[model samples]
Each structure stands twice: as C-alpha cells, then as structure tokens.
Target: METHRIEELERKIQEYETIISEMSAPIIPSIVPQTILIPITGLIRAERFDKIRGNVLNFIHNKDIETAIIDLTDISGERIEDVCLEEIGRELHELASSISLMGVKALFVGMNPELVKRMVLDGIKLESQSFSTFQAALKYLMKQKGLEFRKISE
Candidate 1:
C-alpha cells in the first residue's frame, strides 16, 4: 500500500512538472507589420548630418524605407540661431536636391516657427516640396507608392 501511494504521488508530481514547463515556455506571435520609423534627434551638427545623410542614401539605394521623417520640433529654439539656421537651410536644400536626383521622396517633419521664419527669410528653397504631420507624411508616401488611398468625403 505504501509503495502504491508513493508511485501515485510521483505521477502527480510529474504531471505538475509538465504543466509548469509548458506554462514557462515562451509564446511567439505570428504577425508583424513591416513599416520602418526613424526619428531625427538632437541639434543640426555635422555628425548628425552625416549619419542622416548616410542612412537616407542607403535607404534610397536599397529601396527599403518608404518615408524618412526629419523632425525639427525637438530642436532647441536657441539652436535655430542664425548660424545653425543657415546650416539647416543649406542642408535641407541639398537634401531636397539629392532626393530629386535620386528620384526618391523625403518627407520633413515638425517644422517649428523659428525654422519656418528662417526658411522664409533665408529663402531656403523647399517651397516646391511636400511636407506634413507624421501621419500625413506616411499617407502621402503610401499614396506615392501606388497604394490605395482611402478617400475622405466632404
């Protein structure tokens, strides 16, 4: 009788161990979206410019990224000083020209008031371009890529 009780207890323990092991196993999910999002961070320094320029060119070359958002809202208002603003204007103009040359689309994001003023005063020359909020930029890129646009009715 004692031997039978010990065997029954061991069987129960083995069942519990199996259950615990199954519960501890990691659960892998199936579906994931393929959109890539890159954030532009920090001041408009040359290093930052180089990194961004390299990434942009690579993405353009590989045809992986559909849209690149160059957010400017996080930039310090003081950083938009005359010198930095001039640098930004030149970089943006060059970026736009580069994208045009490569036949790729670049969507700039987060245009602060100071940057806008500087662009106007300095004549940065991004006038004949398209830019918008992050969501709008994504939608525009999708539309440009021949994806179906969900029409909005008036």
Candidate 2:
C-alpha cells in the first residue's frame, strides 16, 4: 500500500516537471501581427532546446506566423560547456532550417559575445538573421510591416 502511494506521487511529480519544462520555452505572439517570439531562459541545456524546437515548430505550423524571434539573452558562455554548445548550435541551425522550410523566417536576438566567440572557435557557423537585442529584432519586424517608432510629446 505504501509503495502504491509513493508511485502515485512520483507520477504526479513527473507531470509537474513536464509542465514546468513546457512553460520554460513559450512561443509568444508579438504585438505585430504574424510574428512570435521564443524567449529562452535558464541554464543552457540540450533538453531545453529540444523543447523549444518542438514547441516553435508546432506552434508555427498551425498558426499564420511570418517571423519567429528566438531570444537567447539568458545563455552565457561561462555556464555552458563545449559539448552542450555544439549540440545547441547544431539544433539552432536545424531549427532555423526547419522553420524556413515551413515558409516562416526565424530571427535570433540577444546572443552574447562570449557564446558567439566559443561557437566560432568550435567552427559552428550558424547562418540566419540575428539581432543584438529583442528591440532590434522587433524593429526589423515592425519595419517589415511598414511600422516605425517615433518620439511622442509627453
């Protein structure tokens, strides 16, 4: 009887973990139409990237999204190892390619210099549109939609 109780608790724990992991990577629709952003947070892990890839692809598949901004501000060079970097880089490239094949453009934002340096040293060249910040990416998207930000009198 005690074993059965423990097993049920384990199952519930696993379910909660799955939910939390799913929440960690969300595809957020932008203020502009047909645009979405995926803000990647927390430690750089292949598992998290896997979830992001699946979620982005699936969400864009059914939706009429034209652009996807992948925010990488939370990843740092010091926190991730070479092997993990390689996997994440490869997956990122593949995810872009997949999104392209689906007729959606993918953009990267907030890539730290250290991570880029490590990727370059590792010979991982990921090709695609990348911005230094979310605002930059959003600016580009807005321009594409024929919108611009102007200073307004207070």
lDDT to native, each model = 0.57, 0.81
lDDT per residue as tens, model 1, 34-153: 234444444345445544665556566755433445555566566543447767777777765665566654556667777778878987777324454666666765665666546899
Best by TM-score: 2
User: What are the models' TM-scores?
Assistant: 0.58, 0.88
Q: What TM-score would you give candidate 1 relative to the actual structure?
A: 0.58
Best model per lDDT: 2
**Candidate 2 pairs with clashing backbones:** none
RMSD of 2: 2.2
Locate the minimum summed-lDDT window of 10 residues in model 2: 77-86
Tell me how far the alpha carbon of residue 43 in candidate 2 is from the true structure, in angstroms, after superposition: 1.7
Residue 111, model 1, lDDT: 73
